[model samples]
Target: MKLIKLDAIDSTNDFLKALSSQEELDNFTVVTAENQTKGKGQMGAKWESESGKNLIMSILVKDFLYDNEQVFNMSVIVSLAVIETLKSLDIPGLSIKWPNDIMSDNKKIGGILIENTIKSDGRIVSVIGLGLNVNQINFGHLQQASSLKVICNVEFDKDSLSFLIIEKIKEKIEFWETNSALFWKEYFNSLFRRGIPTPFKNLYNQNFMGIIKGVSSVGKIQILLEDDSVSEFDIKQIQMLY
Candidate 1:
């Protein structure tokens, strides 16, 4: 577990990607930054965090999955790892909103963005980006944002928290290839709003009500619609209303 700490960087994922391309990097090589000039998030949304007040990190992983078909499994493993790490810290009401939004008490606390590259020899390399609000107390206009500090009302050591999360992710990856089914089961168990009526907005900009039934192996969320039918939607096609 080689760690690289930067005072500032454009994006940790980009830095790690460039490094991996230049040379053979060790597995679980982590890059975390105190400030990001252009932080990224799922769906092109900006991951806004106060400078030095959040965990902005990206990890390099290789040989976790052989091909692209099992890419969604990366999400399952990483999401479950973060959930379990937070649960151990006594963060209450933690759940994974579909895909990979870390939520506590129905408020957004963290998110994950995974970028994979396939080499000519058919090997896959993944850059797992995780952004978690740690000590920040104010979210100017973001109505749905919260932090561990606000939730627990105590300051947390960001260094210790990040290391614990990294360890948990490694633990999951260690047994994933053979025990994948078990990881999927735990992921669904920690899924947010599972089997509960929820509101959603589709790509067509229409509001509809549905219940989350299950997530496809390819990462599409299965929702039970109003007409008693189950439909699958990708992240771009559906937005779960909090």
Candidate 2:
């Protein structure tokens, strides 16, 4: 559980990748950057934030899984881990928007990116990157972003807050590894807009309306259709529209 904190870095994810090849960094080794020069988001989206005003870090976890299918569940692991961390901070209305956005009052407050790499020893390693909006008091032109400072009307000590978050994540990870069913159940309970009809655009660019019924055990999002039946989709297969 050693943490390496950097004043700035090109990207914490990249830093971890570089370290990964240099003799396996132990599981729970964390690298964090106060400012990320080239932050990355899912699907090549850009993750940007005002310098030193957010939480940007990557965790190196070796032996995360045995197969490719289990790789996809990393999203569930990270999202639920973060949700638990935020809840421990007494943050209100915090919920997870599947595949990996953390939301509060329907506004995005954090995100996670889980990358899997195959090691030379035939093991899989997971790099879980998390970017959380913390003490930045204003969203300004970033219409969809929000911060803990904005919500709570007070600033937080960045380093202490980051450590607290990591501690919560570690605790949740253990809980998830032991009680998976209860983990998923708690995760589903924190799902944003669950049971409420929402609009989404599918991969084919077709629009559809469905209610979030919760996620299947296999990790696909279960969407309750208008016909009273249910369907499920992987990430990016369906984009929920705000």
| RMSD, every candidate, angstroms | 0.9, 1.8
What would the TM-scores of all predictions be?
Answer: 0.98, 0.92
What is candidate 2's lDDT per residue for 1-242, written digit by digit as tens?
87898999988998998888886677889998889988888776778878888989998877557777677566776787777667777778998888778998878999888778887777888888999999886777888789888888878677776677667666666676777777677778888999899998999999989999998765689999888899999876889998
Extract clashing residue pairs from model 1. Answer: none
RMSD (Cα, Å) of model 1: 0.9
What's model 1's overall lDDT? 0.93
Give per-residue CA lDDT, model 1, range 1-242, as digits (tens): 99999999989999999999999999999999999888899888888889999999999999887878899999999999899999999999999998999999879999999999998889999999999999999999999999999999999888998899899889989988799999999888889999999999989999999999999999999999999999999999999886
Off by over 4 Å in 1: none
Q: Model 1 residue 84 lDDT?
A: 92
lDDT of each: 0.93, 0.82
Model 2 misplaced regions, further than 4 Å: none
